[model samples]
Target: MHLREVRSNQFKLLLIALLIILCMALAYRLLIVRKNLKIAQQADELQEQKSHLLEQQMALDSLSRQLKVAQQDNQEELRQKQSEYNQKAQEVELLKQQYIQQRQYLLRESTIYKKIQKSVSTPNPDHKELLTDKDWKAIYKCIDTMYPSLSERLVLAGITPTEKKYCYLSFFQLDSKLEAFLLNVNIDTPYKNRTRIRQKLKITGSEEKLYEHLALWG
Candidate 1:
């Protein structure tokens, strides 16, 4: 009976040892599963970060392309403006040349201009003294009709009503100046020269003596 009881006790002890070993094996399996799940979660998070970085890189590339296109457009516009400015400058220069050519042509076509040019090139003292009595009458008529007050003033200054040939010659020259101006002849003589002549005549004290010695001409 004691031997049998001992065998039963040995069997119970073996069963308890097997149960403890099974529990240990299950705890080891749970630890391995938890470690594998943590590794999967970390991999997923890394993939998401990589995708975000790729999206940012694509956006930067798109913006860079747009900036390049904008720069090209601006350069084209600037070139167009420069071309237009050059064209306008050329047109203005052409207009200036045309106007100068037209003015030169008109001056060349003018009869009075030719006469004055001829007179300047070949001066003739005989032409100055070729005035006839009719020409003298016309000169006196112009003075009486156009410059009555100046004629009266000259007569009062004792420069008129004289038979001196130089005095009549001076009067004819003065009348010729008026005719040149009325005909729009572009002589270098300004009206100031006429004023100087009149003022000199007004200031002269002795007209007969002045005419005799050609002092007035001097």
Candidate 2:
């Protein structure tokens, strides 16, 4: 009976050992599966982070392009404004020149302007008398062009150089402002016929004077 009880206790111990081995194998498999699951979760998180980083990089690139475009537009606008400003400045300068010219013309038209004018009756050592047949022709051309109304009424009488700077031109008397000087000269007249009426004229453009004329004719 003792031998039988010993055999029975040995069988129970063997069964208990197999049960312990089975429990140990199952715990090891559970631990391996949990570790694998944790690794998969970590990989998924890394993938999501990579995707987010790519999106941010794309957004930054787009913003950089937009900023460049805006800067270019601003520079173009500034150039256009500068061009307009330059054009306006030129226009203002032109207007100022015109105003000054008009003012000078008005001042010269006054009778007191003659007192301040330099006389051209005196001779000049630097220049010779600009008198020649060609000059007379030029004078006639000027008269016909500038004084068309008086061209038909008058003819070239005589041209005598009063000085190197002044010339005397005689014309038939007319019922006009004889006191005022007539300086538009045109000697290239087709009319070579001489007139009995005579007039002397002295005209000046040099001698630091604006154009002036004095008629010493009846």
Cα displacement (angstroms), candidate 1, residue 162, comes to: 99
Residue 211's lDDT within candidate 1 is 23
RMSD of each: 53.3, 48.3
Q: Write the per-residue lDDT of candidate 2 for residues 1-218, one digit (tens) a residue.
A: 99999999999999999999999999999988886576456445534544454465565555555555555678776565555555555655565455434334433432223321322333334443334465555444432322233433323434433221122232212112221222223332211211112222222233421121321111
**Backbone clashes per model, in order?**
0, 8
- Per-residue lDDT for 124 in model 2? 38
- Candidate 1 accuracy as TM-score: 0.30
Q: Worst lDDT window (10 residues) for model 2?
A: 209-218
Cα-based lDDT for every prediction: 0.47, 0.40
Q: How far is candidate 2 from the true structure (C-alpha RMSD, Å)?
A: 48.3
Top model by lDDT, which number? Answer: 1
